[model samples]
Target: MSSSLEVVIAGGGSPGHVYPGLAIADALRARLPNVSILFAGTGRPLERHLVRAAGYNHMALPAKPAPHNPLEAVRFITDNALGFMAAAWMLREQHTSLVIGLGGYASASTVRAAVGRGIPTVLLEQNATTGRTTKWLSGMVESVCTGFKEVTPYLSPVAEVVHTGTPARPRFLKQYQQWQQQGEVVRRSREPRIVVLGGSGGAQTLNKHMPDVVSRLSEELKDWRVVHQTGEGQLQCTEDRYPSDTSQILTVSYIDELASLLFETDIVVCRAGGTTLAELALAGVPAVVVPFPDASENHQMANAEVYREAGACVVVDEWAAGDRLTDELTSKIRELAADHQRREDMSRAMRGLAHPDAADAIASRCCEILCGTDMRVAA
Candidate 1:
């Protein structure tokens, strides 16, 4: 890979999408010192801050929000067409050798423009099932990358699909090492420290279920120290309902120190987002995953199933609620706590499922696709 080469990355809106882009961009620059990255996305606050923090040249385009109604979809399409034109202009201006679409407003335009100009294009689908955008654009791209093993069936036959795991923040490896050194700190009760999150934005489903969760936490949970990461708009409600001094609960809208908490945590209850799954695998924290039911193609459930198969996590359907949910968590945590070997086995199995060098793998593959070099994926 040539250091002087330029790569344009499209798709970066939320933390779910933006962080992975940053991870890959960092790896690409490290491997190819002369390589440069340009991120093009809508004016998402998360995208703006993260991209600049990564020190990449970014071009922000105005984009329409995700649409639910037919009229909204039409408006979004019309607005996106204009965004695409701006992205095309950026693509031409940057003279990118490789275009990477990460399945967001920006990627749809930038990647398409690169393809239209006969430039090599690569797309990364960070889910067990391809989304509407990825599924449609996959046929036009040079290759498609994924994090899970279950996506092969959905990929286009003509598309060169690579199972390149999405890279997690390097900090998790450090957290895992520290936790292993500390060993297990036994609590008086059987309940484990359960952390709940719904990607960066948090989930209304998870938030709504929080009241039930707090009120019905198993008796064993009394001794457990619980930390819940409820996304914005749900924090105040979660805090008000579940007082920390009253219960073993610490609820926050977000945690900047996620790496530290992940290391200390014994169990996680979260939406089965690709980035979250990757982080959990790296942290070696067994989880009870509740996938976002409406996620495109139900990929979150598919992702959860993959980990569950490896004995890394348990999947609880969104439909299962109230006492059913509480009982499930209690039973699962006790099962793990009662069996030391089970916990150890799960930790090792989960670690095996992680690819810490996923960013490096993606960067290497992108280089291989563009420069005809052997891209190295770190083990």
Candidate 2:
């Protein structure tokens, strides 16, 4: 291994793109303690906060999304051209050994620069359907690490596709191992709990409608508790919807320890972000997946379909449900909550899909590529 080796992980714009990159970073640092890791991404507040809070240095690039119309196309070119120049400079200045792209427009410029410089590059695709950036750069990168095997057909035939599963954060991985050792024991003694997640950015539809959905299940949820993570700035509005007399439902802005919470949760009502679904699989939690309808290329729906086919979740299209969205969600929650045997079956199916060693697998691949020697890192 080269002592002077430094790597850049490029991706952002959302927590879905950033968290998996962080997980890979953690695994890389574990194997190479002295190597420098820098995160390159867009100048979004969420991206900046997450990287800095994880104690990694981050460089903000002038990247923007692909233009939708002719009017925006010119600006897109100007912004990304500047981004590509900045990325090339950063790669040269840092003496970058490897560049890992985490599949988003935010990562396009940096990865393109890396390939142009003939640097070793890898791309991580978290969706079942390949992202536009990943599809565009797939043939050029050294390897494309995928979360779902269904994504294989979408990538360039020349692209080296590795099904390493999705990399989850260290905390989640730790909890997942603990669950494995404990076996599949259902906790019936404690109060059954339901958790609602709207991703890092609160889902307006979920935040506005889920309170009512839970309220509708009042009779069935007499002994059950609900925890709603309403994202930032939406807590007050969410809290207002629940009845004041009952303390059964608790609303919070964010969950810092989601891995811990998932273990205690009976079921989840959430968006179908690839990273979130990967975590749910690790925890073996049954879910009522309400995929964000407007996700890029409807990728969230594609992600949910995999879990649905595996019998791990019930897919609910919020938009298709129309005015019956609340009723549909309520029905799914009620069904899952009432059937203990079914929940356990779904839990087992979910666990069957988990890749506990995903982070290590990806890091090992990166190490092998960097050193030109096959290597596996200890978890």
Candidate 3:
């Protein structure tokens, strides 16, 4: 393989899309030390921060989400056209060997540009119900790597579907390994913790309801504590929701190092984004998943259903719960917290579903497509 091989990872309307791409890039670098990796995406501050923090060059594109109404149609076309042209030029100028698409609106143009340029391309679909971008680009790409095997039927048959699972960051994988070795000793020394993750953008429903749910379990959770990551801008509001006896609950705007936090977590109450689910599985934390109703194609719910079927999580539909959201969440958390055996079973099930080597698997696949040989052995 050439030492100057360049790979552009295109994705990132949200952290869910970006993190997987970063994991893949990390894996690629490990397998091919000289490989150049670039991220192409919208100029969202969050996206830029994450990529730059991971020590990668990012190229901002004029990509916009697909229009929801007729009024947005023209702007969406104009922006994406510019993005497509920019992506095409980037691929040619960088002499890109492979273009990996992590599905989102931001990735559509770049992957399309790669196909137009006849470049080796792979799409990563991180949901049981594949996103629209992945479905549209499936037939054009060389392969569609999926987080869930259930997503295969949604993709085009012309594309090779590889179940690589969701790629978690290296730190999470390392922590998972360490936990496997000494988790029992460590866990026994610490108080049981229930973590509430509202994602990078705080879920309003979770932020409003979780504190109350935790408070309801005060007696049952006498020995336990709750740590809530309320995302940015909602810290004060979420913090205020807790009772005067705040010893049992801690609310923060964000968690800078979630992998470390998960190392000590006994249970998690979070939304069912593919990346979050993958992380929870890796940490082997029993989860009470609340799927975002507004997720693209209800993909979060679909992702949650897979885990629920495997006995890895308890799924709660916030939309369906309506006024009873607090009641339902309290019930689930109460059940999980009280049943030590059940939590252990769920944790085991979660670990059983984890793909610890997902990043490497995806990296190997990309290399095989590029070099026509197994790069794992070559590396």
TM-score against truth, every candidate = 0.88, 0.95, 0.96
Residue pairs with clashing backbones, model 1: 3-34, 3-35
Per-residue lDDT tens digits for candidate 2, residues 79-169, read 9999999999999999999999988889999999999999999999888997656787899988999999999988998999999999887
TM-score for candidate 3: 0.96
Note the Cα lDDT for every prediction shown: 0.76, 0.89, 0.89
lDDT of 1 at 339: 63
Give the per-residue lDDT digits (tens) of candidate 3, residues 1-379.
5688889999897898899999999888877888889999986999999999999999999998868898899999999999999999999999999999998889999999999999999999999997656777898888888999999888887779999999997789999889878866776588999999989888888999988887788889889988999989999988998887668788888888999888778899999999999999998899999999988789999999999999999999988999999999999999998898998899889999999988888988898887778344445
| Candidate 1 local lDDT, 258-376, one digit each (tens) | 87777667777788988898988888787878888877678888898989999898788876654476566555656664565776677777778887777877888887876677555
In candidate 2, which residue pairs clash? none
lDDT, candidate 1, at 2: 46
Model 3 stretches astray by more than 4 angstroms: 374-379
Among the numbered candidates, top TM-score falls to 3
Give the deviation of candidate 1 from the true structure as CA RMSD.
3.4
Error of 2 at 269 (Å): 0.5
TM-score computed on alpha carbons, candidate 1: 0.88
